[model samples]
Target chain A: MNSVAFVIIAIFTLAAALAAATLPNLMHAALCLVLALLGLASFFFLLGAEFVGLVLVFIYVGAVAVLIVFTILLTGRDSREHRGFNWSGVVIALAVFGCLTWAILKAQSLTIVPPHIRALTVRQIGQVLMAGYVWPLQCVGVLLTAALIGALVLVLEEKR
Target chain B: MTPTLQAFLIVSAGLFSIGLLAALSRRHAIFILIGIEMMLAAANLNFIAFWHFAPPPHPSTGVMIAIFSIAISAAEAAVGLAMVIAVYRHYRTTNVDQFNQLKG
Candidate 1:
């Protein structure tokens, strides 16, 4: 059952990612991004990262993808022009893929006996985050604040 | 056959490659941002796959890292789109080839 689900979700994710990468329409690409992100969230769940998966759904699909769409709408430009095929880009992508595949295949496998993990819950995650990971959490909070301020400063129209 | 960690890693590699293609080939700033997002998602997927397969002592570490990565990308996407808006307003175009001021 889980394997079937994984196959379905993986296919959805890859297809959506392909569309997001290749679609000529920016709006269509943004919509595809949402689908890809949602599919990723499902992958997280399949891997037993439940809390993180839910957060991915909320923050990525709900917030970031929506933000991309809003930016497109607010810019009010026709961003549909295809830049044609980039031969150099295709070559680079293939090169990178080859390198990565070779490296992944050459590397020694580290498949340890799966350690016994106590069932993880949202409460456990929150506790651990606030306890052990508080410093990094605070730093991310600062980064988020900075981003919000920077965005506002950039987009806010000056009254002439 | 049940999906193995190698299967997940292969998918991630494919996604990353596709994303690189998007980021490199797309002339539009927004598409580049989308590509970057895809790459980031691929990285997160890799992290989760390793965490699940290895089952670390601190089991949540992978998830924790994934969370932080996602948070950072969210911030990145906001700032990046804001920059794209500013660039569009200034140059009246988003095509990478047309922008000539940066070539020194």
Candidate 2:
């Protein structure tokens, strides 16, 4: 039963992702993208990453999707381009997939460092994130702050 | 293959490939945004798989990264769409053809 559920979720997620990628209608694609994100969150839950799952729903579906919609609404431009899937692109994509699969398989043969498993919890993460990865985390914060400032400038700029 | 971790892995691979193709071949910026979202989900799936199949002794290993990525990607989408809007305002279109102002 659980396997069935996972399969169903996987199918829906992949279908929605494909729709988001290939659908020419921007609004429809965005809606599909939201669905895809929701499906991924559910997958996370099934896999026991409850916090991660909730974050996916809250951040991707709630914040990111909403922002995309808001931007689309603000533009007031009709998405008129009707793009049927290109057979050429399909062939090319398959080739790319084949090559990537081969590469991943080849790499998989190599022995690599296994992930250390001392503990796994939000509390442990909070400790490691602040103690060991503090500088890098701060760097990420600074990068986001810069991005926010850049966005502010761009949005406030004069339009021609 | 039997339906288990392997099946999920294959589906994740397919999803990631679809995302890559969309990002590479699509002309619209919004399509590319969707592609990025798909790719992020693929990574999240990988995290979940490791958590379920070969997780660390602790309870939070791969899951924390997945959660962080989701939050970071949200900020990414926000700034990304804002820039898209600015670009549209500048050139009156979101078509990728006209977006090559820095071509050297």
After superposing candidate 2, which stretches have Cα over 4 Å from the reference?
Answer: A82-87, A99-128, B1-3, B55-59, B100-104
lDDT of each: 0.84, 0.73
- For candidate 2, report its TM-score: 0.83
Question: Candidate 1: which stretches are off by over 4 Å?
Answer: A110-117, A158-160, B55-58, B102-104
lDDT tens readout by residue for model 1, B10-86: 77998899899989988888889999999999999999888888745656788889999999999999999998787
Clashing pairs in 2: A117-B57, A119-B58, A120-B58, A120-B59, A120-B60, A121-B60
Native interface contacts retained, candidate 1: 0.64
Model 2 C-alpha lDDT per residue in residues A37-106, reported as the tens digit of each score: 8888888777666667777888777788888888777765846543544466667767876875666556
lDDT of 1 by residue, A77-141 (tens): 66685558677988998899889887876667843444544567888889989999999999999
Task: Record all residue pairs in model 1 with backbone atoms less than 3 Å apart, i.e. clashing.
Answer: none
